[model samples]
Target chain A: MDPISLAFGLILDPYVLTVMVLAGSFGLFMGAIPGLSATMATALLVPVTFFMEPVPALAAIVTATAMAIFAGDIPGALLRIPGTPASAAYTNEAHTMTMNGKAEMALGLSLTGAILGGLFGSAVLATSAPVLADIALRFSSFEYFWLACMGLTCAAFVSSGTAVKGFVSLLLGLFIATIGIDPMSGHPRFTFGNVDLMGGIQFIPAMIGMFAFAEVIRSVTATTPHFRPPQERIGNIFKGLGPVLMRYKVNLLRGSVIGTAVGALPGAGSDIAAWISYAVGKKFSKEPEKFGTGHPEGIVDAGSSNNAGLGGSWVPALVFGIPGDSITAIVIGVLYMKGMNPGPTVFLYQPELIYAVFLSFFLANLMLLPLGLTAIKSSKRLLLVPREILMPIILLFCIVGTFAINNTVFDVGVMLVLGLIAYLMEENGFPIAPAILGLVLGPLLEDSFITSMIKADGDLLAFFDRPIAAALGVVTILIWIVPLVVRLRRRGRLPEGVG
Target chain B: MKVNDAVPGAILIVFAAGVFQQTLGFPPMPGQDYGSRLFPQVIAGLMTLCGLSLIATGIANRHSEPLFVPAEWMRSPPHFVNFLLLVGLLIFYILVAGWLGFIPTAFIILTLLMTRLRGRGHLISTLAIAAVASLVMQQFFGQLLRVPLPWGIVPPVYW
Candidate 1:
């Protein structure tokens, strides 16, 4: 069958359709909550995916992440508290718009912009992934080592906080990844004689612990003041969105392009993409003075950019098997668990599955329109769900979900310990996303490095002998050195970039 | 209680040192030049450097202001007590959930947390919510998804 026909048939399966709706709703719910995130939404779905077919499993993650990114705007508009970090960029502007009784217009523009940006990103992914994968198929261990280094370097540099802290987090994750038996040496590294540690640290449980469990602790200790839901009744969310989108069409296009580009880069994700697009939008806006005071221009651009970045992230993940962001990092784990090892060969080997994954992005974005509207309309009621009830329920789910992964109480113990570790790390301003990415990529990094070393007979210069590897190695080195050079040239002054 | 960045920085440095020491004990591969310890040793070295930089940054900023900013809930005894209670409940669930079973454990934890935290006088409503949520989650995850929730004393229902 033709790829398009095959993709349609796969997506149209009753099981896939049902899973999409359920996942979409769950994503909306998670994103509408003040403390929950897109990463947490995906992490929570890992157990559910265990019961699903590969197509539906991939579909669930794709659909859920898109919905979550868009739904983040609901809390930002109503409560001035961004439901997800991606919405943090424009939360003040969205809240200001809400105060001025333009909440519907703000939400409508966000919804529309997300759809457009997502479709644009999906287009880029569909066209670029195959070509990129074909080229990436030529890569050997030498190329992969540099590629992994490039990813880790990007993780350290791209994060908004202290670069040292980001590196520390990455190192911590890499250390955790080293706990299992050595792939090449066939010796246990850090199991410390524990039987459960032999299989290494379970990724899903650690993820649930860090993202969901830590969130539960932070929410309960709850220092932030809760505002009563705004009295403004949301009328036609689509109202006046068309004129605003038309007026700021250039901003929308620029945001989508920038977001897609950023998302394709390793380590940078939708949150960073949204913040960058918003900053860029504000910089070039004709009515810059109107920003943070009910301005729709930045909102339009950032909303589009964040969702677009989601699709863009899939590019690297599907093509190179390297995650473009933390979400894709988890998606890569899911891909591996599903026995769909992502790489250029996947394009040739599983064309139908790849096309179906791409098509699901389109379908998910289309579904976002109706689902997002319903979410915005009833957002007031949604926010009213007391944390006292919701949090405990979430806690129960976390416990059950961790256990469900390996069906072991030992995994729950891992979850508890790691959850505490994550909380402490975040409390000290350490970025957790990079750590998660490091854990996902650590084994790949080790395997590639070892293979390359053996192949070269311990010659360090051999890594740079291949033209592609040389170029990649040079690029990675430049990424590390250029930032330090700039920092030194400025006499230790940090660039005024979006944190 | 929150400590200054210097404390975490110091802890990381020590931790990295310990890891580096541990890597010295890993048995080398017989034929390959790169052993199991090479990547971890590299990670430890990087961590040590980063940890030193963090320590420098923290000490440089120390004279400016107090680094510890306690949460608002910590100021109030009742709130702090409530927070501790919740933590204790989480630990309790982790310890006994397998033996007590998911449905009963979840029901008890959710009910207690809700009543103490937000339920106040709405006892009946809180109980209803706890029961319903526990049942729905049990049925969805255990039966529908085949997660094998511990049965404990409750009769297991097959769907």
Candidate 2:
């Protein structure tokens, strides 16, 4: 059978369809909660997916994340709190719309925008990924080394806090990655004489620790006043949504394009895409002053952009095995575990699987229409699920999830220790996403560097010998140095206009 | 609690030094010039530099920032207890779950945490929720997924 038919066969299987629907509902629940995020939802889903075939596994994640991103807007519209960071960009605008008794329109626009933009991104992914994979098939260790470095550097730089803190978190992750046996020499590095340490720290438990468990700790410790659910009832969300979408058709297109472009960049995800799209939407609007005053225009752009970004992020992940965001970082881990080893080779070896993933994106976005509307309709009761009861249950789920991966208590211990450290790290303004990216990419970065070094026989300049490698290397180096130079110049330690 | 960057910076510096020290003992690959030590050494070196930069910035902002800032939750007794209890409960599970079994341990942990967070007034509801949740989790993960969750002291029940 051809790849398309095979993909159709895989997706249309009853089991995979069941998994997608269940995952969509799960995503909507997780995303509509204020504290839980799309990344956490993916992290929590990993162990369950571990038991499934690669097709269902990837489909579950894709469906969950796409639904999660759209569902985040529900809380933003109702309670003025973004369910996920991706919805934060237009939370004010959305909440203001709710305040003005336009809750239906606000949520309606978000759902419609998300569905359209997600489809556009999936189209771009379907078209562009194969072509990129063809280009990527030519890459060697040197080129890969530069790409890995560039990805890590971008992650550190793009994080919210000081670059130094982000870099430190990344280093911490890299150091943790080195704890097991050295892949190159078959020698132990930092095992500290423990048998379990020989295999290195497992990323699954570590992810649950950092994302889900740490979030549990934060929610329990939070002293802020709880938000009340919106009093207004939502009715006929799709009513009159057509004329509004028709009016903002151009904004929708622009947001999708911008979202796909931004999301395709390594280390930038839907959160950043949403922010950029919202700002761009405001800047280009004919009535910019009305923004944050129940304006649906910015909401349309950012809402679409965030969901579109889910599809956009998969490009680099599928083509090069380099993740575009933390969620994709988890996907990369899953890919490795499944022996798919995401890269151009996956395209060559299993084109049907790749097509199935593409098809799943389409299925997920279409599923979002009904699932998202149902969530919006039931937003009040969903939001009313007390965190007190919900959190302990989630914590139990985390423990079970972590334990299920390897069925070892040692993994559970890893979760406990790492979760605390993550909590402390975040409390001190350090970003956790870069550390995740670093952990996922550490072996890739190290292996590529070591292989390239061996090929060069200790010659440093040979790293830049290849044209593509040279360009990537130069860009990566400039990213590191230019920021330092600017900082020094700002401090009067260097002459102005030195560049 | 949040601390000055200098604190974490100094800790990182010490940690990097230890990593660098440890890497010195790794032998080179038999035929290759570079060995297992090179990658770790490079990471340690970069980490050291980052640590220093953090320390420098922390010192520069010392006057404006406190050595440590207690989070608002720390000042609230209930919130502080909630934080401690959650961490304590996780550690408790790590220690006892294997011997006491998954369902009972999960039930205890969930009930205790919920009662603490939701208050004594909701004890009965907390118990009900915890019982149902633990059973559902056992069914979902232990049975359906075949995760081999420990049965410990309890008799194993099979469908």
Candidate 3:
């Protein structure tokens, strides 16, 4: 089956089409909730994918994740509360726009930006995935180990103001990752004798607990007086798409490119892609000052770029069998479980299935536009909801969602414990994002580092011998040092007696 | 409780020691070198370093305020208790899930939790919620896909 034939077949599949729209809408709904993130939605829904035909399942997951990601901006825009940490950067600006009576306009730009970026990212993925996947295929375990390390490090740093703090977070994640059966020795590293611990911490549950439950804990504590959102007298939310288009064409293009590039980087996920693009956007925007103050451009650029990141991340999975983000990582696992080995092999061997996936993604990306618009309109009511009322429901979702995965009692316990810890950590000015990243990437770094050591007879130089590995290592070091040096320079030589 | 500096420092030192001890307990691999302990030891060592750093930084920024509890959190006992109870509920649900089955356990947990949190309505909501949750999980997850749901008190029809 040729790609074109598969694509047409996917278009005609009723199940695939229905799933695309429904999942997109569901993603938007879940993303609008404070803690139920796109990643969680994707993970929880992954189990369900086992029930469907490959095309519908993949399309549903993709559509839901994409729409959910964009919908995160809605809460960020309406309530100074960001639905996902990715939207945290633009929370101030979007909320301010809402306060200033541009709620409709703010939502409009965010939706438009998300649609444009999704389209742009899909186009990039459609065109350039083959080339990038080829490059990614050249990678060995050596490259992957470093790549994962680099991702952990970057995620850690971007998540916080301090550099060492980020490193610590990555270390923590590595530590947790190492908890399960030692990939090398088959020895249980951290599980003390319980069969349940053999699998280590369930990522989805821990992620939900850490990211979602933690938010519930915070909302419970931070009793800001509930007030209704100021009514937007403006009739049209799509008030000013022209300026956004004319002014931010370059930013949008560059953001999509960056999103695609970062997304292709095996370890760098969509969240990082969005942040880096926003950094790039603000750094180069002619009206940099207008950013973070409700300029539709800022919200649009960030949202669109992040959504574009979805495609970028997918490219590696489809072609090289490597996941660029946590969500895609699950998708890769699902594909394999269904007997598809994603990579050039998947494209060449299972042409029909692969093309169906590609076409499904295309429709999924397009589907986000209407779903995003509908989300914006409905979620505006979130602003009208009382915090006390809305928060409890969100909390319910988090609890139910966490328990739904694995249906394990231990997991629910883990969620509660982690959430409590997250709440305390937040209060102490210690960020939780790095911690989650640490929990995630910790074992990957350790496994690779140790495996590489064993493979190379314990020679440290072996890590740097491979050019790609060396380059990634150098980049990681640079990422660490540059921040340290800058901070020291600003703070006047680190107060002389530092550490 | 130790002040900020002493608290983190003391805690890290204690926890790092435990980590070290745990790492040392891994069984050695007979012929295949690089025992499981090696990885844990390495991570624990890194953790020790980080812990020490936390101690140093925490002390550097220490003030005369309370050591264990932050001022903002001191006023919110109900919320704190609420959080703890939520956690407890999850643990309870987990314990009964295998025996009660996924649908029943989830429904029960949802009802009990919502009611405990002062959610409105009474038995009607609980039974309604339980029936709905059971049917949804059955049709969607169990029937549609072979993912399998738990069956304990009442045997799962599919299973």
DockQ numbers for every candidate? 0.66, 0.83, 0.44
Per-residue lDDT of candidate 3, residues A1-499 (tens digit)? 5667867887667767777777777787778876567876775575566567777778888888888878888877776777776676677888898887787777777777777777777887777766655676676667767776666666565554455555555565566667778767778877888887898886666666766677666665554544455344435676666876777787778877887788777556667777888888888888889887767666666767788888888886677555676677667656865788666656656667766666766777677666777667666575454444444445545555555566666776777777776665655555555566556555656666777877888678887898878997888779768876887787896567584
Candidate 1 lDDT, B1-159, residue by residue in tens: 455777777888899889889889999888767799898889888887887887788788898635776767789676787678777887887778778888888889888888877747978998999999999989988988888888877777666
**TM-score, second chain, candidate 1:** 0.90
Candidate 2 — which residues are off by over 4 angstroms? A493-499
Shift in Å, residue A258, candidate 3: 4.4
* Candidate 3 accuracy as lDDT: 0.68
Q: Give per-residue CA lDDT, model 1, range A279-305, as digits (tens).
A: 999999998999999999999889999
**Candidate that beats the other on TM-score, 1 or 2, i.e. the better one:** 2
- Could you say which candidate leads in TM-score? 2
Cα lDDT over the full model 2: 0.93
Which RMSD values do the candidates have, in order?
2.8, 1.8, 4.3
Q: What's the distance in Å from true for residue A412, model 2? A: 1.0
Model 1 alpha-carbon miss at residue A231, Å: 1.6
lDDT score for residue A217 of model 2: 90
- Native contact fraction per model: 0.66, 0.89, 0.44
